[model samples]
Target chain A: MILTVTLNTALDVTYRVDRLRPHGSNRVRAKAERAGGKGVNVARVLRALGREAVVTGFAGGTAGAALRRELAEAGLPERLLPIAGETRRTVAVVDESAGDTTLLLEPGPTVPAEDWERMLHHLGRLLPGAAAVVLSGSLPPGVPEDAYGRLVRLAHDHGVPAVVDADGAALRAALAAGPDLVKPNADELAAATGLADPAAAAAALLDGGAAAVVASLGPDGLIASTPQGSWRARPPRPLAGNPTGAGDAAVAALTLGLVDATPWPQRLAEAVALSAAAVRAPLAGDFDPDVHRRLRPLVDVRPLHPPRSA
Target chain B: MILTVTLNTALDVTYRVDRLRPHGSNRVRAKAERAGGKGVNVARVLRALGREAVVTGFAGGTAGAALRRELAEAGLPERLLPIAGETRRTVAVVDESAGDTTLLLEPGPTVPAEDWERMLHHLGRLLPGAAAVVLSGSLPPGVPEDAYGRLVRLAHDHGVPAVVDADGAALRAALAAGPDLVKPNADELAAATGLADPAAAAAALLDGGAAAVVASLGPDGLIASTPQGSWRARPPRPLAGNPTGAGDAAVAALTLGLVDATPWPQRLAEAVALSAAAVRAPLAGDFDPDVHRRLRPLVDVRPLHPPRSA
Candidate 1:
């Protein structure tokens, strides 16, 4: 079974308002909520595609309980470590008419040192049986940026490959531990390497110690680079839909490839197909099974441009 | 024991932000949560003032459970009726530098017919021995406009006084049921009576079948009218604060008066003093004990104009 970790999970709430007027009260016409964190989203898509994935992370107070209940209802298994404070809620006021989403994110509760250790202990036990472990999302307060690096070494110690999907310092720290794979969007790759071109940024990540790197270019599709080979794949035609969880979908496909020992080119093609399918899905990380199967064969794959002459 | 009813209870969440910009994403710096609804606010204040109060009304799902936990932490007994949907949250974005507050109110979940019946059954059990029943705030969907009226009649049938604090049709409907008291802010009173003068509106409410009426005039204090007498009690000085829960504080004082059978003049004075004291307190419905005591003598009470010539 695939293992996913979301250290700073959130109860994602979306409220539909006619319009959002700052400093003025607006009435919501409809509301939707779901358990959220990068790893959680990845696990959700994995399950939707008929994969077994368990989510483990920090959850506390009422919001945490709500997250667990929502996950259970969605048929996702979660092993959350309890903390003292309530989980955070990220509110998105989506204006139906304008199609604009205004986001308000709370930093979430601070995890005590004891809770952090407890989570590490739990993860240590779960990593042994895991086919691959995916660590994603932000680090909650009181957790050091280097926590992911430590977890990466633990996964390796248990003979399990690890996939890291995070941003900023945590991503930087995790890269030094030689993760099996790292997935970063165009902007996140740019920030990590200060490189404007995706090719240059992907190379930087590969050199930083990842066994390989798959950089998501959104509508531009997926690009994968390894020491032995490189490949590129994109959808037939651009899809129109919310692209919120496309990266998570790609990550899920990548993990599936590792578990099944699929070749790099096939893995890249599958990741591209799943990510495109996710963009067309209304709810995040969910793709229509029939559509997914139909689109899987359409993913066009080719050799990427040779790495920059450095 | 006092029974407080909040038809549309909410989980009040306050998020502190350094600067709030419209159409831009913001990260909340700090967070706080409390059980909120006008009647819940009154009950919390009553408990803080050394009174025993039981909060009864709708609460459901995880957010509702959080609301219950907050009430318990405040040391108040809660008899919340569970429903199918979760309670809503009212977001208050506080800007400390400017001392400005931006409110984002969620309409809360709708109450099913069964939920309403369950609440009525609960009230039926509590009304007989209750000193007073306080019905407050906006009614959730699936509840009739005459819900407050029905509750008022129920209280009267059991020989218990009812104090209602609401706006528009809810308050008007309660008046037709001859509730022991109705508390309307200046705007609601004007809209209810079509009279610009608050005192005249108070008289109109009493004439409309209400046993008594209290007009909350913001920092100007309160105007109270009953069959026995009419009076005005003005706070000595106008103070500025987030006036979110001042009216709830006034309702708490009014409930206290009915229980003690205090005369209208004294009741008006207490209401004004409590409201003023609330402005100085940090949280909603909370009054600084010292300020509450000090403001008692400053409340200026004057006899209302005798029944106007027809």
Candidate 2:
């Protein structure tokens, strides 16, 4: 089973309104609530793809209770550490008329030092039996920048592969521990490598210590680099809809590929096809089975030059 | 016992922040939640002043649960009618530096017609036992403008004194029922009567059908007009603090006075003194007992000619 970590969990609230007026009272026509965090999104996508995924993180207070209840209702396995403060809430105002969305995001509750240490200690206990672990999303306050790096080293010590999905300092810090795979979108890769080209950025990350680096190009699909081979895969065309969690879908496919020992080319092709299918799903982290089946045949995988070892 | 009705109930969330930047994310340093509606605030103050206040109206969903839990925690009795939708939440960002507040209020959930009838029916059962019934706050959707009017008539039908603490059509409609008293702040009174002068506005409302009118003039104290007499009662002075719920405190004092048979001159003095004390109590209701006692002696209550009989 895949284990995922999300330090900053939120109760996501979406309100459907006819129009949004600043500083004006609104009567929300419809409202929905869901548990949210990057790793939680990844776990949800894995579940949608028929894979077993367990979520672990710090959840607290009433909002935390609501989150756990929602996870139970959604049938997701979770082992959340209770903290002292309430979990945060993020609000999204969806104005369907003009097709523009305005988001009001809350930066969640601050995690205490003891809570952060407890989460790491919890990860130490769970890593041994897990085949692969995912360390994702922003680190809440009190968790150091090298947190993901520490988790990566712990996973390596336990003989478990770790997939790191983050950006900025946390992503840069995780590379020295040699994660099995690192997924950064084109812009994030550019920021990490100080290179403008996506292909060159992926090469720099692989050289830095990642066993394989998959550069997600969003609408252009994905470019994968590994020790044995490198490949570029593209969907027939860009899928239409909200692309919020398509990358999480790709992470699900990558995790499955590693566990099943699928060839690099086939894994890259599957990841692209699944991601395209995910965009068309109404809610994030879900793929329409029909769309997935229809798009799988259109993914084109081609060999690319392997990066030169230093 | 004093009975208060809150048609549009809200979960009032207070967040402490250094400042408020529109369209930007905010991390609340301090957080608190409470059930809020004008009538609810009145009931809370009454409880603090050692009075039994029974609160009623609509409440629903998880937010409603939170509201009930908070009210119970505060040691106040509640008889909220559970509706299908959750109550609205109003966010107050308090910037301690500037001592200024920005309010983001949501239009409360619309009550269904059947639910409205149930609430009215609940009032019917409770009105007979109340010494005074206080109808306060805005009318939620699906509740008619004449709702307060109908409720006022209900109280009078049972020979109980009724006070209407609302604005616009709801206040206008309630006046037709000739409630014992109507309290409108300077702004509400101005809007309702189209008169900028507080004394003139109070007289206009009294002439319109209300047996009496009490115009709350913020730090200037209160002015009341009855067919028997008219008087102005001003407090000693103002204190340093948030003045958000001062008006509600005034209402609480007035209601308590009427029920306890405190003479009108003393009632006017008590309302002003209690409202001043509320400024010192911050978010919690009830004036500082010592300060209230001290200021009560200084309240200047002088009689004048009543509005010339129409």
TM-score of each: 0.91, 0.80
Q: Which ten residues in a row have the lowest lDDT in candidate 2 chain B?
A: B19-28
Question: What's the lDDT for residue B291 in model 2?
Answer: 75
- lDDT by residue (tens digit), candidate 1, B226-287: 87778889999998876889999999999999999887778888888899889988788688
Q: What is the C-alpha lDDT of each candidate?
A: 0.88, 0.84
The candidate 2 chain A region of ten consecutive residues with least summed lDDT is A19-28
Which run of 10 residues does model 1 chain A get worst, by summed lDDT?
A301-310
Model 1: pairs clashing at backbone N, Cα or C within 3 Å? none
Against the true structure, candidate 1 reaches a TM-score of 0.91
* Interface RMSD, Å, model 1: 1.4
lDDT of 1 at B275: 91
Please tell me which predicted candidate would have the highest lDDT against the true structure: 1
Alpha carbon lDDT of residue B198, candidate 2? 82
